[model samples]
Target: MENTRNVLDFFQKIVKEEPDVSAAVAAIRTLMNILENFGDGETLRGLSEELRKATEEMKKAECSITSVQSGCELFQRFITLTSLEQSNFKDCKEIMKKRGEIFLRKLQEARPKIARLGAPFILDGHKILTHSKSRVVLQTLVEAAVISKKRFHVFITESHPDLSGVAMRDELLKHSIGSTLILDSAMGYVMESVDLVLVGAEGVVESGGIINKIGTYTMALCAKEMHKPFYVLAESFKFVRLYPLNQRDLPQELKFSSTIIESNHSNLLDQHPQVDYTPPGYLTLLFTDLGILTPSAVSDELIKLYL
Candidate 1:
């Protein structure tokens, strides 16, 4: 139950500074750290059950899609470690520790590669529109400006309900990149002149679609209408096997609240979903750690990973 609580709390706590992949990596690290502190055989067995419970809890919640996928990966890693040469208790602990170290190292390596691989898309003299918040997207833009020495303007929508895009805008400016902040409603109005649309994903499904902040799908539609090249910058780890056919198939959390709306009605916020699904058709390409891939190529990559 305690591990269950930790998993529940982790899923509920949204760290704005970290994107879905970052948060997931942090969660797995935390879990591994906790296990490392208690290395006895009985404790390991107990932790195994607790970790499984935690993974199931994540599955049941409105977790970031990367959290769901990473949680599963961490559990599988634990299982693999347990299956290793268990001739000695100390050796088993060593294996688990080494596995954790390797996982962390891989996660660290993927982030920068994602930035460098996607930064090329941010050419000079182009206006890029992005919504919500994505650390990877910010890093990509910053890399283009600082490392690549390319000058570009970034237009960010003030992602509503939380206004995370304002943070993105500020971060871009801090990196000495040109940026502008606009309201969520101004996506169409602001995107008319945008040469490219670079967005980040909470999860990239096997079907090549992406799950992101609520306004992303709309922004993607607007970008498509404007004939702008819309790109998604995602680490390969954020890709999930789940394929949602439409927004309705998404597990959207709705809270009934009228506090934000100065209205006579009380249930105005009842149907507000924090995230939505953007179809693959709206996407121009997915710049991933594997390579720049068309939306339809997502399933092929997943198959390759599994094989």
Candidate 2:
């Protein structure tokens, strides 16, 4: 229980100190810290169990668990792979720590690579529409403007319940990028004006679909109907092994924020869902560190990693 509290505090502290850092990265870093300080002579199974408990604690502390869940899953996979190569438990722990550091370094390098890949698509005078706040998306915009010197306007949805889009708009304006903040309901009204839709994912599921901010699916539907291309900017680590046929197909814990899940309210209708699944069909392409991949390619990547 104490370790779990420490995990939660460290996770929250990282988020508070670095507002741009994704929860997934913070979760990974927190786990790495646990790996470093984990007591000597503990069995690999014991360490894995401890890590699982810490992950659950962090999940309960956050409004959205997609990133935390995915990060833990990937980290656990690293442990599994390391254990296969080493017989000594201590050697396996050391190897995992070294590999974990490398993995984190790669993740840090991913955004810049993705920015370069995504920048070409931001042509001069293109009117881009983005939902919510994504560090990768923001960096790509900055890359297009600062590095490529492309002139463009951005329309951001006022991602409600959190108003994260407001923050995104402010950040873009800080970079001297022209932007307009619109209501979530106004996506359709702005669809004709938007040349393309760019969004960030909390989790890119196996079916090439995405689990993201609640309104992403609606925005994708709007883009599809308007015949506008919808692009997603996400890192490779954001991918998860899950297939959701629809919203209801999502796991219960993945649907609501910690607050909603812990709420005493007997009626679920009173609570708003934290995230939604956007099917692969609605996505034109995914801008990832791996490359520009069509939706179908996501499963191929997952197969190589998991299978």
Candidate 3:
């Protein structure tokens, strides 16, 4: 329990400096670990209360440090933290649904600016390509489609192992939005005809690199080769400070998952891959809730937040 509290405190310190999804997630995960490891009902309740207070403090700090759009991202982070810390599974699901709603609201608020100033202008019948599933990007496109009063064709990559793009396709279909699901390998072939590429990041480092679901870096490489515009939609909180120390030491964390190591057969081991890193230069623009930033600008942004 002491070790768990120490980890939680470490995450909280990071959150105080960089109020992004990564830090918020770390905090939430640490809290969840405490609950999972120490199964005392009263203690769990006390930790939950403490986490709730921390979340509120994080929010107040975020609003003070960033713009309204950034504030929205902070709110989403809080909602995510709250949802994860919920003791009841049913309540967690309900909170997740509400979190999605809050995310949608934030995306809606930033749509006009993102369409006009963030991404390149799309012609009347332009097709936009996207990889994986991003609620933020999806909501942005939906808002664009509605504002344009015309169909905006979207090509979505069927993210493998997860196939989250399937969910993206279904959501688009329900909204009567035009969309096509393509194999992840087909991204390069389809790049030439697509107007722009939009992706979401799980984390963005001060060095301008980003961490996302597997296949994002490949897409960015393709976009770079094709001279196509590739944009990342992420909140500033995702920005991390990753500097090497003493030329011999570097910060690293091991993410262990049974899902990755244990499979039905050894032959099928390579089938399920998770996580990839996208270098910053390949990204043309990062559309944050704060505003648009070039990949080069990420370091400066992080400095402002960290220093």
Listed per model in order, the count of residue pairs whose N, CA or C atoms clash below 3 Å is 0, 0, 1
Report the Cα lDDT for residue 207, model 1: 92
Q: Between the candidate structures 1 and 3, which one is better when assessed by lDDT?
A: 1
Instruction: Check candidate 2 and list the clashing pairs.
Output: none
Off by over 4 Å in 1: 1-3, 6-21, 43-46, 56-90, 252-269
Instruction: Give the better candidate number (1 or 2) by TM-score.
Output: 2
Model 1 clash number: 0
Quick one: best lDDT, which candidate?
A: 2
lDDT by residue for model 1 (1-307), tens: 3456665665545433354446567556655655566546654566666666665555544445454554456435643555456875556666777777776677688768889888877788988889988888988988899999999888899998888998888788788889889989998998888899999987888899998888899999998898999999987767776788987776432121223233425554455766788999999999887888999999998767555
Candidate 1 achieves a global lDDT of: 0.74
Q: Candidate 2, TM-score vs. the true structure?
A: 0.97
Q: Give each model's whole-structure lDDT.
A: 0.74, 0.89, 0.62
lDDT of 3 by residue, 3-62 (tens): 434654655666566633343444444344444444333443464565555443343321
Residue 217 lDDT (model 3): 78
Question: What is the per-residue lDDT of model 2 for residues 81-145, given as tens digits with 9 covering 90 to 100?
Answer: 75557877788888888888988998899899999999999999999999999899999999999
Q: Rank the candidates by TM-score, best first.
A: 2, 1, 3
